[model samples]
Target chain A: MACMNEDGQWIVLMGLLTALGLFFLALIINQSALVGQTTAEGVLEFPKNDIRDLRSEIFDVYDSYGTLHAQGRLGDVEEDIIRISLERKNAVVHFGNDTPQDVSGRDLHPVTIHYNNGVTEYDEIVYY
Target chain B: MVNDSGQLYTMEGVAAGVIMLLTAYIVISTTSIYTPGDTHIPDMQLEQLGSDVLAMMDTPDREGGTSQLVGFVKNGTETCGGNDLRNEFLTNCKMRAGDEDTKLRAQVYLSYRRTDGTVNTTPLSLPDPEFTGRENAVRVTRWVQLDGILPGIPDIEHSSRPRAVLVEVLLWRA
Candidate 1:
């Protein structure tokens, strides 16, 4: 081994470095592609539209039928919502409104809504 | 040392390799790489557009005014008002900047609670004549608050109590 010169060794070393650099670049590209995939998957998985639609639907209930409570016919309607949400949406939902409270010289009902579908949980309290 | 003549060749190879790597990086960075998400892209777009249409239909043109969606639901399946809703929805969906999208179509359904305490879904619009049952469709729902008796629905018994109903639209491209 001592008879051989080591002058071309640097060339071999540089070729190895070049190969490593290219591998790193490929890895970086793969990581970037992963980023894009997660973004789209995240948007589709979270039921943003479903939650918003539920909120609006609850508000619509309040608009048509006065203040809601846990008793009488209004309670039955609320039960309908909860049961249907669980069945069709694969989500558990509960919502109700109490007697109107004075807000800025106006009487508005205090409504509360709770929703959970395993992945996400949401709670909302609004006056209508 | 020994054989310094090959040093120039080594230097040229190193330069070429570095240049190629840098060029590749620049080119890749400039263009977008859509991986694993292209399959869901069309579904995402259709869902967004469908939701937008439902939201717009439910929105009142002016403050403290009734929306067209509510009016159609109140008219029920027995009347021509439901037909109007279908027409309006299709027209809105097909309308675009460049040209009308005739391939887009929709069917409407109403979900209501029965007296026995179960939810029931009834079709407000008939099934599409061209529907082969294999087309991919997105269902978008909006809540409609109906006042008093559901006079139009033959199945449901009339009750004086107000109620909330779900209006669902299934959109697809033929």
Candidate 2:
């Protein structure tokens, strides 16, 4: 067979180059979108507000500990906290305030709080 | 006419190229990936920290005593006690396992109701000097229930009655 006239060979080469360039550009854009999405998702996933709320509630209980203990309702309140956290929030939660320890000339009680949802776990020993 | 059979192949190639370019452009533009350094996450974190600090200050460490937050609101003058509030807020917010400073600044405002039922806001703390009026500040508020009207604040007919007041804090990193 005789060789055909190759008049438009440059068009095909240009088309391939354009396609490759576009492919790379798309890849880079895809990676950038993933970066933003993961950052927002990670922030949303971490239970910051839950941990803060739990800490405040624990401190409130600590504040009222003497009165609640005198009235024998401390255990009830503690049970309520744990049960509600487990049932509603899907987190196992427990906290207890130890005897008031003198730190820097101030009586501050050492409180230990534990929290665990399926996704994240937080434990802290805060002086209230 | 060059009796061109290659014209059809060239046309096909042009169409394919146009289609691929359009697809890539649309895909890239439609995703619209925003810059990750936007204000949302930091605002959320600052607001959360401000609220946590406020709530902590409102909690009394022992029974039968008023919370420090309540006392500050009830007795604070327009210019005084802001230092204490600022110091305490910074102390609580910056306290971590390590002693690294978080470099946060806050200004407190109190919202109360007049006797004719108009809500008023009064500044309890001043914003820092570094606040150049363009910072990304977050406002966090808390409801403080008082047994009696705040003593220092004037122009309220129900000063002797129980009231619920809102304490707002504008927080930013200086």
Q: Which candidate comes out best when scored by lDDT?
A: 1
TM-score versus the correct structure, for each prediction:
0.78, 0.53
Model 1: docking quality category: acceptable
Q: How far is candidate 1 from the true structure (C-alpha RMSD, Å)?
A: 4.2
Residue B121 of model 2, lDDT score: 69
- The stretch of ten residues in a row with the least summed lDDT in candidate 1 chain A is A64-73
Candidate 1: global Cα-lDDT?
A: 0.76
Off by over 4 Å in 2: A1-18, A21-128, B1-37, B78-80, B97-102, B154-158
lDDT values of the candidates? 0.76, 0.69
Give the TM-score (0 to 1) of chain B in model 2. 0.71
For each candidate, report its DockQ versus the true two-chain complex. 0.35, 0.05
